[model samples]
Target: MNPLGPGDPLRLGPYRLVAVLGDGGMGRVYLGRDGTGRAAAVKVLRRELAYDQNMAQRFVREAQVAQAVTSMGVARVLGAWYEGSWPWMATEFLAGPTLDQHIEEYGPFDDLGVRELGAALARALQDIHAAGLVHRDLKPSNIVMTSSGPRIIDFGIARPEHGLTLTLTGQIPVTPGYGAPEQVLGHRVGPPADVFSLGAVLVYAASGERAYDGGHVATVQYEVVHGEPNLSEVPEPIRVLVAPCLAKDPAHRPIPAQIAAACATSSGTKPSAKKIWQLGELAADIKQREAAAKQLISVPDVRTPSAPSRRRLITALAAGGGTVLAAGGGGLAWWLLSKDGGQGEARKPSEEESTAPPKPWDAKRLTASQYEDGTTPPSLWGPQEGPSPVVVQPLPVRDLVLVHDGGSTTLGAYNVIDGKRKWGTDVGSYARYVAPSDELVVTVGPVTVGRTGRLLALDSATGEKKWTAPADAVHVIAADAESVYFTARRDWRQSDVSLLGAFDMASRTTRWTVPMPVECTLVTPPEAATDSGRLVLCGQNGKVVALDTHTGKQVWTLPRQAVAILPIAPAVSKGIVYLGGKSLTARKLQSGEEIWSLPAKSEFKKTYGGWGAPVLDGDALYALDGEEISRRDRRDGKADWTRSLGDVLQQLDPPVVQGKTVWANVHSLDSGGIAVLHKDTGKPAWTYARDGSGGWGMAASGNRVFLVHGGKLTAMPVF
Candidate 1:
């Protein structure tokens, strides 16, 4: 606490200000008291900002935002002045230090302290989100260590523009490490964004270091978006838990309840307001301050401020989402949503309003997000039935993506850079194929709901539904700038036969659909067969076939040996189709003529439960076979080179080619790790291993390697 400065207020309404509690970008917090001697922490907005309509609007919404947060796991609001010369509000005084202060005073906490802290904070977040609020800034300073428990102070009530504010010293008013990628880009801020921060908070408590320490705001923001968080110093249980919370894709992070359960136990008693007072020398100092404050004020005179009870929220927000707030003693109500993706509404600055083109799609980020299946929540408009569970995975961006509420049960486009939402609709629980023109297909029915399958087309840019088609688990196989080709089972529940079709992306009208001659069970949509883009696709119909993408007419077909039942997606390069499961086969792309078939009995354990696709690199093809990476000839299926992993390898995931190297995830005996190899000679270049399980994955972008396996997308630096 600091002494009152020259411009400080002595009194505001019924409270007498004493000392400065803290300072922030928008306002100053003071230790104050009512006439009855009850102490309160009051916040006074900056005089200049109080007059600005935008600032005033945000300031007034504090009452509403605060009301949304339940009194559990946080300091309670005692009084508020909605209309005063200097807008001010008071909350219960917490007699303790902040997480930041405690960490600085003592050293870093042990694993037990970290776990307890995580539990308390996760519960706080659970209550906040239950109130339909996202605690945008959830850092150490915002958490006060009280005797009862850690109190989450200062809920994100102030909504500054794009979360970018220039301070008196020209530094930004935010901590970049605690903010997620979407927060930096000014995309949608959701509960998952808070979870990402939670991961950072846990890292700090355990190791006394920011996970992404770039020093400055710009560098930190860049690191949050591109670089992986360094968690080497973090030990086992905590490291394992913190990793998923910091996933690049929000969907992969476990929910708060899950977090609480996972980090449930603590060797020490849970952190509370009483703990600090009992253990440390500061107890005397805190007592002295409490007595001094009480001596200055009299007792038992004024009426206590009674906050209104939480009833049903009635305000309709801008994104057409349900917004139920108290509205400042029911003072004012407003709503927000992102045009690309987020809970907040899109509000561009004045200068770029007329000329800003659509935000570009971050292809790498999009590809990374594709594997996440973010199931929607029960409410998009307000808090969910049970603490209003929200699933804001696949964050959106402006003009380029469609935002959806966290766990929104809808089809939405999200921007890769900031997780801003473009548009969203009730298309279904999952999205399928992405077309060239930014239109994607999603499934309408899920088996859990016991509903038949149907397909819907949505504008990825707008989140608007274009058309609907009845189909059985349709999977996109091939796509171009104008159309999308797909394959589906004739009867999803019973038949092994399938059909192929072509549909114009814009109109969503089927050009044609044809039945397959062979009744194979496994299949995928059409793919480009030749270098010039002739349509070729594979199916368990026991064959690789070529079709005219425009007409859906089969050009040629070559059956796989009738013995192989499960066929993997074909890998096409030059003019060959490489598809197999327990067996490997090469066929002509244009005519579907057999080139070669590697028998199933070869010394390769490529498939475990599912077939592994071949990795194509110029002329050589690679596949994970048991304990080695085998490089085969693209033309004659002849062996080029093989590098034995020396230990039993996990099932192979699709491989990725970068320059002259190939990268993938593998498992050996007691560990899971990633390995990089020379594409031509099949010699090892680099490898990194840990104790956890890993999938064999193969996507790369920028300086990072993207792996999609086990239903998760992970980004790790090549280094």
Candidate 2:
């Protein structure tokens, strides 16, 4: 809590404000007391926004919603004045830390404690649902632990059951990793959505980690909508009780009633919240908070000179939970403030104006069936023939899979759903040169007899040219958010000299162009990958160079670490790049510092087989060496497990990890198709065998694996 500042109102209606609990963009929360000596957490609209009709109405709605819910698991509303020049609302002051704070201060709860917490939260949801409301945001930060039990707070985004989830232009509706799938998808939410949130909350309470987490917000939200809930750290008994509540489909989830019943004790009695809160370290913490609250409120007023500065005293008390009284109330009504300070309309994902392409097809989640052991999973779309074998995996962008048309020098976009051609344009290159940048596909046009090739950006959906760059490009190496890196001729006059160049996507101009090594030429364009701020270029003869993406300056280089006649794949993650060829190596992205290296093994002692590009998923790095596929730790080059194919494959293709299955292209004299291996054990699960094959080019997206072999293209479910 902080001392009252200039222009701070000492009182609101009957309550006299003492100290500030917290303040944010929307409003300020103050500790107040009434004539009867009753304490209340008073929330006032910011003076700058108080005059706005929408902001003022939100305060009224919050008060009404708070008062409508009749439950011991929430703070009771005291009084509200929305029509006044300064709108404010008061609620019963709550002491103790929030659920997230407690979880951080003390460890996760025991099994019994988790059950009691779940039961109380379930009942709270029951009350909130009965009032025809859905608590759109129910993360740990919105839950406060009082002496009585856990109390849900911050109803800022709460709306009627029919309400569509939406937020301001720059804000997300709910917290990442905790929001239910429907909420994350911007769908209309109901009581079952709250049940799903409860399941996630219980997971965190039991395991001390989020049920769904990722490096980015979009990634976490994607996991909630499509990925499975992570329950590996959760105890078995609790897992059985909570798993049903996290079902992706709202209809499949257990309701609050069912959750409450399942969490009951063996005696057929519901877990007691009071008993749970009155014991252990939690009880001690709560008692200390209550004592501090009593002592702070006992102070006569902020003007009492005899007392230490109320601001300093309350700020000190804050750490002990004394000033935690409705601290969440300050930023509670965030959605009320729009860019223009008017009521914002509901914005659904499908309705929003965005340039990002639609996510690729996810057939497995739609079908909801796991393939039986030893049985090949069915294809989601096709084995439709006509596309030539690809050097790179087919790119799934928007609704189409971009590939090189069969034996033609044109880029073809095929429908991801049914493997039908959508559009084809003469890109004058193979599939290896096409790169996706949101809705735009970047590629190089065919360089005619006397004219130089041009860089083009076509709409992923319509294949219409959107932007272009004048460069004598031979190959479209790769693209990141900022720029596209490619190998191009110096100019029409110096057409014989090959140069490495970057084209800024935003500015639509040449960023920087630098001469490539004498070994790198136009005929054999290097295989390049860009990420973070570095561009990794690997030559066909195994020369590797790293250049700063911002400026075309070379950062580091590796001198023929690989002895492959083919392009060695360089995969980047975090700050390290994993390369495969003569040896599987992990090196620092900025400098050529070696992190770890593993020698490739072969049946013949005199020969060293090349390793495929390393594929990274979580902590595991997977690559194929000769006939053996190995899964090793990404941090160190130590192998976790390995599986060998009796017959060698056509090429050293990296294994693709999707869901729980690792899909690898297998081609031998006797069998040729896709090989499915268990991600954890590296044991063969099933194989889809195809007769007469030139090996398969594979890519996994939206829970489906896309394979391009010979003139055939197919999409299979991940199982």
TM-score of each: 0.38, 0.51
Model 1 C-alpha lDDT per residue in residues 641-711, reported as the tens digit of each score? 87776665444345666544566666666776667776667767666453445434344433234433333
Candidate 1: residue 355 lDDT (0-100): 21
* Segments of candidate 1 deviating more than 4 angstroms: 1-10, 19-22, 156-173, 265-719
Best by TM-score: 2
Worst 10 residues of 2 by lDDT: 346-355
Q: Write the per-residue lDDT of candidate 2 for residues 1-719, one digit (tens) a residue.
A: 55678778888899988877667545788888999888878888777777778767766675666577778876666677874577887777776777886665444665667888898999999998888888877878778888888988765456777765424457787888888898888777788888888999999987777999999999999999999999987877789988998999899998888888888754332233246567544675677667666766787777657766744564344334222444434433111112222235221111111112335454534233566768886777778876866544688885678777776577888887888899988876562455545588888876666777789888888989987778788777788655777777766556364788888776778888998752555445676776545788887667788886766778788877666555666887544788988788988665657879988785322223668777877557889888888888877788889998667643555788876678776777766877888878898888877775565788776666788876788887764
Which regions of candidate 2 are displaced past 4 Å?
1-360, 365-370, 389-392, 491-497, 518-524, 603-608, 669-671
Instruction: Supply the global lDDT for candidate 1.
Output: 0.54
